[model samples]
Target: MPEVKSQVDPSDASPFTRVRQLAQRAGLDGFLLALLGAILLAYLWPHFGSDDGPLPLNQIANYGVSIIFFFYGLRLSPEKLKAGLSNWRLHLVVQTTTFLVFPLLLIAARPFFDTGNQKLLWLGGFYLAALPSTVSSSVVMVSIAGGNLPAAIFNASISSLLGVFVTPIWMALYLPNGGHNSSLWGTIGNLALQVLLPVVVGVLLHRWLSAWAKRYDKQTRYLDQSIILLIVYTSFCESFYRGIFQGYQLTSILLLGVLLLALFFGVYAWILLVSKVLGFEKGDTITALFCGSKKSLVQGTVMSKVLFPDARLAGIVLLPLMMYHALQILIASIIAQAIGRRAAPEVPVPEPVAGT
Candidate 1:
């Protein structure tokens, strides 16, 4: 019989194919592409979802944010948190790095951005530092790196809960009095209503709904991302309308990106050193590296809505976080892959069989 020939379509050899191949090689996959697309679309059509626009996007996004946290609560496993609580030392280090060390580092950089809008930009950086470690990504990266998965989940979950209270207190120190529609106590109350209440309810229902939540996890994530994108779009629209981004030079934006990258690596290195100094095991060190280094875009976006009611300032505040989010995912993914490769179990050599 003649050997079978393989079929290859000419369309498969197109330039689009080559571009996709190159993108994959460089790790710029669909999610990153979608993020870029969202920004560009926000920039080009800022009016589409503006406060005075055709649709009530802001209101919808506000509700969506609450739902996102609700699902987050639903998905969290109390058993996992209980199991991981034994690692008190590791938890202390991760949380300290997140809320304390990260802020101090950004505060130290304040002298550099002491100019006009640069100060606001610095505030953005400070807010990013004050935010919590990402739950999903931190756990994902830790698992990928053969780390203590339970501890990662515990720290990330606890970090989010802590941020609901801690982040606003930190911001209150800097944010102008009466910038919000409500007083500090009122703001916290509102946040509790919108974010914390849903979370509490979801957690209460988790025993019954966890399996359902697990089944629809991907859809939940998609909803979260969509809500985030809507928030971003509305934020930029407000910024564009008020000319908040106009004063910012392109170089300034680029510098912010560079600074965010440096901040990520700097924190990562500090965490790694601390892990070593504290005599953490390899797995625990990996958990610290991932959990201590990450800042949650989810928490940042949701909290920003409640924290900064000033729409114009919200976009500026979110800028550093947005950049950090992208950079962290890119850098952490590469690092996780490297760590995973090192931790992978070696294949056992097969013994030659007597029959062979």
Candidate 2:
């Protein structure tokens, strides 16, 4: 047996290695694919509901963010609060970027949106800017990069919590097309019921549910992704059904894509520069830069009804969110990996010292 052994190349062998390789291979971004799928599903949504009734599928899509948040609470431990308290500076930078700088950038770019369609596009960007930082992906990036897991988790969760309030306030200040006449208190109730309530329930039961959450986390992630894709498809489908693109052209979308890419990279670069100037180490800077720049799709969707009740304008409001989410994931994933490689040699002591 030893004499007859055949050698396997390191890159060509092992299931774990192969799976990671496959994941790393370039393809259409998963979020983009999910969005496209959601659009197709949305197109078919109205058919399932009624002649003039809400599509059951679209209704299901509406709960996507809540479901995601519930699963989030189930997974996150109460320990996160303690962790959040420990890294005040990192949390400070991330929160400032998410709640302050991002929105400011969106506001500054408003003057350039002159075209009738351009305003909608700019509003979309602004809506995206108002949303909070993401939780899962940012933590994943930080963990993979060997940056700081506790800090990432803390900042990400706090950002989501903060977004529940900040997103609406920013909309009141900057969102242009006007849909704010709805009962603000009722909207708050809707947010509490749909988003925060489930999370609160899950957090309350986390002691009993932690093991279950850990076991089913992968399944829950799939569910989250599937629901989001459904939302994207259904939303776009409604646009198609309503002839939403009657005047909107491919050129406009293309231009918007370029602009979105610029916005993501520009904010990311700014964060990196700021973190460096502030004297953060490489790992903390990497974590800060990623955590600061990304926006939350879940937050945007859940908050939009309150922020922009005019369903006519809601889709445009979501455009920037959709674009930014996709771009940030792809760009940040690459940058995180590169940073991980560069910082590998300098990573702190993997195992703690003996006897404390």
Candidate 3:
């Protein structure tokens, strides 16, 4: 006789189990959930990192950012980056989108906002466009989506380096009289010492430490996210204390959110079209889509201190970027999971013998 078999009913599963299954399916994992919590905490306790606050959160965040990039550089394989560089077409597309397409889009939208406050807000949007793709999140999302990881790493790293010069030139076009005293060379020097030096050190040590770095990849990711949260908290704190957010009306804020969403999807769609036109493989396409769509909050926050000079307007300038950062993560997480699922190989089950 055939062996008896039992099947569990879906209805019999506990509510907690069902909810967990749904969340897993939807990619709403703990990290994404914690991001929402981080925003709430920032809103509730923005004063902690204010200009006259009890803590030195900004200084701590600056150090943390360097460490984050150091680990990032440690994980990157020099051989992989060199090999990936041969894919010049992919590199051209991703970089062009980051440095050219994004800024052009925002510039085209300038005529829509003519008033003083509107122009400031528009400048915030333009600033977001001028920035480079994020390092950690861009690579993370592309890997999660089964993209060309090496190319993703190469493009993201180069984008950050390029932004050191490119972003300032873009800002100078419109912010000529913003009263910032620092020269562009001074800004570059600051970035080279704080951001570039640590990266070079990590790269030099990568051969000896690569295995250990891979071993603790998950922990490093958590550390990266923690540092980002710290930065967000301090940035929002400065904004909250200065009433920077209050300068905008509710309708305008909502519209800005909508515009950011549109910008994300618009770039994503353009990348998809371009990748198809170039006849890219699935992995390369995924890398291009993710890297092209993201803007770097890390670069933005660091550059803001140097570029804005004025503490009050710096917070306001950061607002659009903050919103874009959160939205990109949320949207990209969902999309990456969907692509991962689609790319996943189907497991073949064994067939039963005739007389088992």
Candidate 4:
């Protein structure tokens, strides 16, 4: 008999290890917990992250946003983006589902939330709907499900760029009387400076810097997470200091959570059916599902600061987005793993030997 190695059985693991394993299987990220922790910290000590606070957190977060997009652009290749565009049919479906289908679904839900706190929650949902697909999560989910990575990357990149303009336009159209109407052009200009400009500069330097950016991808991700936590903390700091989140009860918040999940599944079902109707290959279907259904919390967070004018309002806008971001990650991770397992090709069984 062969000697056994020193492997430990999972059942023999400690409680903490078992919990960690369960979390990993469920696709839970520590960042999500950190996000909630940031909010809690903000609630407890709002002044630390506020405008007059010693830290100047908002400004730091703003600068970090620029660096995030710049590094994003630096890591991508113009040639690859072009190459990924060859599938016009797939591209059209993905983009249409992203910009048109997602927002329209929310627009249809506006009537149900015309009064009170519901309206604010509904507005947040609409904003999320209008936002672009996420870059990393969409691509990661698609890749796990055996989708076309090139197309996922291209669609995600293009979607972020498009959202810089499109999200503002959607807000302008929907909020004409909400004080943000006339400022659409101004908002776009600010985004151009903070978002578009950095991306353009990064792309220009991609040939020289792409390798360095890729080499330090893990570090960059940590920096991105830190910046996001800072942004969330500062935003909620202003909200708590101003007493914005106190108006709604916990039940209302829970209701919004339920509604957001409905929104996700509604979109997912639509994409699942339509991709089949369009005769999408497995990869294309996977890409369409993931890329089409995602919302970009990164872009949403940065843009909320520019769009809301008030930090408290920005915090309100981010509420649904933060919840949706967590929910989508969990559900999508499960789906991706399931699809990966089921979609794998079966190994061929060998025929019986004639001699036997």
Instruction: Write candidate 3's Cα lDDT for 1-356 as tens digits.
Output: 99989998978999998996666444455654565566567668877776678988777877886786688678767887787778899999999999999999999999999987788789899999999998777887787788998898899888877887788878777773636435666556666776778778888999999899999988987787777667656766777777767767989988999999999999999999999999999999999999999998767866675567555566668778877876787688778867776877352211110000
**Model 4 lDDT tens row, 306-354:** 7776776667778999989888888888888777778774522111100
Per-candidate Cα lDDT values, in order, are 0.82, 0.70, 0.78, 0.82
RMSD of each: 7.0, 5.8, 6.9, 7.0
lDDT of 1 by residue, 48-106 (tens): 76787899988888898789889988998888888888999999999999999999998
The candidate with the higher TM-score, 3 or 4, is: 4
lDDT at 250 for candidate 2? 86
List candidate 3 segments past 4 Å from native: 1-35, 136-147, 175-182, 301-309, 333-356
lDDT of 3: 0.78
Q: TM-score for candidate 4, please give it.
A: 0.92
